[model samples]
Target: MKVLLTYTSMTGRNEKIANYLADYLKEKGADVDLEEIIDTDAFGLTDYDAVIVESYTYHDGEVPDEAQDFYEDLADVDLERTKFAVLGSSSKKHIHFGRAVDYFTMQLNSSNGEQVSDSVKIDQDPDEDDFKRVRDLGDRVLKSLK
Candidate 1:
């Protein structure tokens, strides 16, 4: 399957998660294209069979500035044929932890993207348990293609 994994990270936590997911998906025999949200421009959802968007929430559950354009682009597109999942990282102390994932879920649903699994939210840095959840997430996405 053709998969695109994109993320925006300030402390690199999200980047690490994205990389792990990419590698795991590749190992599962997927053709994965990984990129940072800032480095991408005018991408279409139809280009890939599935997409995974990972992001860190900014103040009050807002999308980070670096990933705003990519978020907006996804919101603006028709994702009828795209299956996607969202991964969010945030501090558990925050009242809106994982709000970015919720936001992306709404946007993806609005744009007609098929949600392959429930969104994954990581509190702070990932640990062994978090890695297992991420791996399960990747497995779910890959399994959806069949």
Candidate 2:
């Protein structure tokens, strides 16, 4: 399967998570493309069989400024043939923890992408269990291709 994994990170937490997921997916034999969210084109999603998005929620529950364009552009794209999953690392200290993950999940669904896994919201950094969930999420995305 051809998979695109796009992400944005400020404190490097999300970046670490993105890489871990990418490695996990690659080990499973998926042709994975990893890119920053700013470098990804929402319209280009049609080229991939699946997409996995990871992001850090900005202060007060906002998508990072750099990812705003790609987030908005999803509204214009149709991804009925693509499977998707979203996950993010954000401080649970914030009232709206990991809101960016929620936003991406909803937006992808709205754009007609099949959600292969439930969105994961991690607190601050990932713990062992968090990493396991991330792996399970990747596994689900890959399994969807069958």
Candidate 3:
């Protein structure tokens, strides 16, 4: 499976989790690509069978700036053939926790992208359980391909 992991991180928490998820997927024998949302291009997105969007929630339910363009570019894709999952990293203490994931999932669905299932949300101080959810998200995405 060709998978793309695109992420935007401000405090490095999201970056670390994105990398961890990428490594886990790679270990499972899936072809994975990791791109910082800011560096991603439209062409790169077409190459992946699945795209996992990772983002941090900012004030008032906003997605970070670095990923806004990446999210916007998603509208241009012919998403009928793609499978995707949204992984959100946020602090539960934040008022808008997991809101970015919700928005991205909605946007992707509106653009005709197939959602594997619900989103996976990791909290500020994620433990092993949080990591398991990430793995589960990957598993569900792969499952959809079959």
Highest lDDT: which candidate? 2
TM-score list, all predictions:
0.95, 0.98, 0.93
What does candidate 2's lDDT look like per residue over 47-145, in tens digits?
999999999999889999999999999999999758999999999888999898999999999999999999999998899999999999999999999
Instruction: State the C-alpha lDDT per candidate.
Output: 0.88, 0.94, 0.84
lDDT of 3 at 48: 79
lDDT score, candidate 1? 0.88
Instruction: Tell me each candidate's RMSD, in Å, in order.
Output: 1.1, 0.7, 1.4
Model 3 vs truth, CA RMSD: 1.4
Q: Is candidate 1 or candidate 3 better by TM-score?
A: 1
Order of all candidates by lDDT, from best down to worst?
2, 1, 3
Which regions of candidate 2 deviate over 4 angstroms? none
- Model 3 scores a C-alpha lDDT of 0.84
Worst 10 residues of 3 by lDDT: 40-49
Local accuracy of candidate 3 as per-residue lDDT tens digits, 1-146: 99999898888988999999899989988899998989988546657789999888988889788788877877776677578889878888878888999989888887778889679888875689988888899889888876
Query: Could you tally the backbone clashes for each prediction?
Result: 0, 0, 0
Maximum-TM-score candidate? 2
Global fold similarity of model 2 (TM-score): 0.98
